[model samples]
Target: MGGVNCLRSLVVLAIVCLMTLFVAQRHKGLTFYKIDAPVLIAHGGGGLPEATTSNSLEALQRSKAVGFCLIEVDFDLSNDEVQLDRKMKDGSPILRDDLSNLTPMTLADLVAWMAKNPTIRIVTDTKDSNEKLIARLSQTGLKEQLIVQVYQADQYQIARNAGFDTIILTLYQSTMSDDEILEFAKANRPFAVTIPRKRATNGNLPERLHEEGVQVLINTINDVWEGKAFLKRGISGFYSDTLMPKGTSSC
Candidate 1:
């Protein structure tokens, strides 16, 4: 019985790897599974309940126990990229993604945490504008698990060239027109296009996304209705905060 079960598991694993590799050919070398289910992907370093732990093992374990294999997390860069989002004292963009200088954990800290939790997959956000740290992260052994999300097309291309893809390029708030969005997909085939749940109003985005050969994933939805609505809207996937555990009401 054990042998049979092991064989079955191996077959499934092989299939998953093949599918991942197939999708990854365009987005550098990282393969992503297009999970169509309404995903309760938690953010913060750790999973929920211990999300405040900031990438601690307890938070990861909680996410695991909650049956969340997919989630979002941040990787603080070593060097700060001074932009203009939240300017510093001098009115500069806060280059403070990782808090190695201000906060406790550094880049090394996040890498160490990733090593401890191998089962969890993450859509890694740069938080600021540091491609160097992202480049370094692409070289990790667990590189396949990381989805490099960049808003800038130039940065996206840079990361794509680095052999660490699984990417989701953030669309500017309500700026992507359907034709533009379709064009974007044609240019970046197979990689996911991340859209806000509220902005996924065009009933044709899903069809066009499929026709354009790009995956569709919505983000940051917290309400149960939103989750269900996105699923019904034909979104390829979505992120959530509730972190639904197994046997819990999907409601």
Candidate 2:
């Protein structure tokens, strides 16, 4: 009986060591992306008030000031030449889809701003071709700070081929099975995947993704209760309008 008990203890110790090795390997795989988990990414630069509308320079600045290190901004081409958020009634360029007092900023403008604010990273929400977008960004020498959000597998490949180190495949409109999504992540090896908060809670998607060391980021979380709920569900981070209410802790 004494011998048997000693053998059982040895087995348990071996199993614990193996589990620790596995976890360390998984963490090393994620280290290539260089992102801190449970991050707060501002949606359209925090989607702040009229003085700092979405996708505007003011919005980006305000987001950084309020303790956000990552900001998502929209990008689209104007006449297939210049990159602008949208065009107004008079065909004047603007930073957001809705017309506002904030002036439109081109890709160059944003990159130059980022050069001055190196601590901030920008997530490019672009439906246009990655080749064109990358070409434009490369001119500014700030492409390393970009995280491209793509919809299609081909776009993911394009971003990778264009030498982007960080890429996210958005699953907001995906109807694929959980297995399919896992396979897609396995093949593409994106830095993260973004899904609507509703779908993020429905299945075992988050757990499966976590097992593979891929981070799961949910979109459009504006309140603290919902943010905490998702974080409790093992979500890696959020695309949020506000980081969290003042004096509130995300942990």
Candidate 3:
């Protein structure tokens, strides 16, 4: 009788554990594992001295060569055309070192590259027109390879509905208070939330988000030790210009 009771207790415990996992999975957006996994996302294809141009194809190649699987690209909408340009200070994203001329990549160019490199996933960032961009990328049939970053809380569902199962809610552009942000995160539960490095260091948002089963990523981290410190404070990953994972070297 004692043995039978012990077996029953084990079975009950297993059932509870499975239920907890199911709830957590349901709360997270689609492709939970993809976003929740701790990864070093190369910012602007990484910061190699020769290939430091932001969002350039050459930089992307260098980052890939360094064994980075996740890469972030910034896009801007101009005249109804999507182009890769993080900052348009000189009306040009970057000047080509080889050509000594300003050249930027188009959406079509990125799509073609993504088709060829199926293993590398892209994280998209834009100040505006995020839904439009998400819709456009979804139409390319590479939804699985794209991770959409929405600046607004309401844009979360819009992105998810656009066939982008993996969506990250980036908070840099938001005006919501920390409590409001936490409330929305608890309600909608995006795959992850990326905060500025200042926010991650100065507040308890990272720990609070982690408690809600939401992964947190900090941006523009260039130092590995800084990344390590945030990881200890509940940050799951970082968007870094040059910080690569252990065993990976940047060229």
Candidate 4:
């Protein structure tokens, strides 16, 4: 009789374990990138050595040769119009770009370029991405490759409402506490968080983010050691612009 009772208890334990696994998977929403190590995401248009990048054919060739799988670029709306307005550190504005020029790009033009480059994925910053522009992008061939990112929570809601399943955004610098960040990350369950390396708060913060189903990607890492440090702290990836590190390789 005791043996039969033990077998029944074992069956109950197994059922509980499977249920726990199901809940864990539902909560974690973290999709493994299948990409290991830190990914080198090209900043700007990967263009000229000067201030503003080319965003031209040259940028595409350069990034591909360097083995960069991700390209991060700016996409803004005019606020008054659906036309794009982007700003680069070089002081060039996308609005100022000539319609026939190759130096800069507009959002509509950006989508056209993405369709041309099917090999690389893009993380587009929607600083001013508006309803009309987003609707247009949703109809583009490159919509699947774009990650709609915004710093504002309202924008997050907008993207979600627009049927964007993946979002790359950051915690507010001023008001977000670690506890709150963790709760929000898990609750909303974005694909990833793109934040400056300096703003990660601490090692624990990233782990918490991960626990909440958000992968932390530290941005603008040119130094190799800093990249390694983030890796040690459990960050999923980083935004880098240099060549491969002397030692380690892919994740």
Candidate 5:
């Protein structure tokens, strides 16, 4: 009787240890590029309340000051395709969101600022060719700190060819079936996939992606509750135009 009880206890202990190890392995596998789950990416540098413009250096600074380490910035080529310019000031490239603004932050200005502040990571939303954008970022020596969001497979290939460590596929179109999406994800092995807030909230895509060890991030989530809800649904992160308050833990 006593021997039988001891054997049962040993068996239970072994099962518990195995379960713990499996959970740890699963958690480690879910991390993207060493960044843990529940990332908060500030969209366009988070210029809400009408104070600053999106993609402006002021907005980026504000987001950083509010404890957001990840910021998404838009990169667009000039009309002539000569260079990547968000806005222009006297025919020179600038970072201001408003085209009519004279006091615009140039790419050089942003690079200098980033040099001073090295903790911030950038998410590049390129409106030009991936090769061009990657070349531009590489010039600043910040390519390693970037998570490039690509809309097409060719763009993804270009970024991969450029040796980008982190790439995100922005799937805004519903033209592709779920199987197609999964197959593409398997083939490309992107760090994460960005989808619409509605789809992320209502579907099992997030779970399916998690099973495949891919992270799901929702875009343009302005409401704090909505962002929390998505996180509860096992979303890896969200892009938001308004920064969450200081000390908001993703865990």
Candidate 6:
């Protein structure tokens, strides 16, 4: 009976190994052009000294002058229009802040800006209105320039169907286990995965994703040395507020 039980265990282990191999082989999802895109994403348009306000036109201009082609912007629905809005630490809305006295920027305004700057690709970070934003941007013939970030797995298909070829499955809003996350990346094949800094450093998640040919991006990094540390660990890049490549400056 002991011999029989041992034989069963061996068979089970073999089956599991085969299953793992099968899954790894299927990780090649559709490759978008941005897979080998820039290594640094200007967080909230970057250039802190020049552009004190994030998600503003001035911030974007400063970021562009800093030689960044990739910029991450937060979105929110306001007055039945998409606006560049990110809440402050004290929970005050960016547009309504008495201090900044900034004007609200609508989607139409952004589209015009995008048309002028042909090389810049916008990475969206919309909390709940990604579907609306994707549809709206797609209609404007900017589908190729938009890298939509989806919070859920099903949203990936939705974004793809909306004419977006590049999609990023950000892990900040997901509750999936590490193994499950890896499986999702292998199966769906998003252009990249955005991970919180803490989670990126926790385990071999970044390495595993790289093995599957999925690029990994860490969020909200500011220091130059910290970004280098993550890059050393095989992290593809960072969503940084101020960090930029060497010899590139807002000045």
* Top model number, lDDT: 3
Q: Model 1 over residues 137-208: C-alpha lDDT tens digits?
A: 766777776777766556667777888767776664336577877776688773688776556664567667
lDDT of each: 0.58, 0.71, 0.76, 0.60, 0.70, 0.74
Worst 10 residues of 5 by lDDT: 28-37
Error of 1 at 17 (Å): 56
Model 5, stretches more than 4 Å misplaced? Answer: 1-37, 51-53, 80-85, 93-103, 173-175, 245-251
Model 1 misplacement above 4 A: 1-40, 46-57, 78-104, 172-176, 202-204, 211-213, 245-251
| TM-score for each predicted model, relative to the true structure | 0.63, 0.74, 0.76, 0.65, 0.73, 0.76
Q: What TM-score would candidate 3 get against the native? A: 0.76
**Model 1: how far is 211 from its true place, Å?**
4.6
**Candidate 6 clashing pairs, residues 3+ apart or interchain:** none
Candidate 4 per-residue C-alpha lDDT over 1-251 given as tens digits, one digit per residue, 9 for 90 to 100: 99999999999999999999998885553221212465556665442333233455455555665566677665555434332334443444443443224445555566677676676677764444345555656666566687776565556777777767767765433266667666767778777776676677444778777666678887666566677777887787776554332333231
| Residue 15 in model 3: lDDT | 100
Worst 10 residues of 4 by lDDT: 27-36
Query: What residue runs in model 6 are displaced by over 4 Å at the alpha carbon?
Result: 1-38, 50-53, 86-104, 247-251
Backbone clashes for every candidate come to 2, 0, 0, 2, 0, 0
Residue-level lDDT of model 3, residues 95-189, one tens digit each, is 44542433456788889999989888999988658878887888888898988898988888898777788888888898878898889889887
**What are the root-mean-square deviations of the candidates from the true structure over C-alphas?**
17.6, 17.1, 18.2, 19.9, 16.4, 17.6
Q: Which residue pairs overlap in candidate 3's backbone?
A: none
How many pairs of residues in model 2 come into backbone collision? 0
Clashing pairs in 1: 83-93, 87-92
Q: Output candidate 5 Cα RMSD.
A: 16.4
Cα lDDT of model 6 by residue, 148-219, tens digit: 998878788989998888989888888878898899999988889889988887778888898889999998
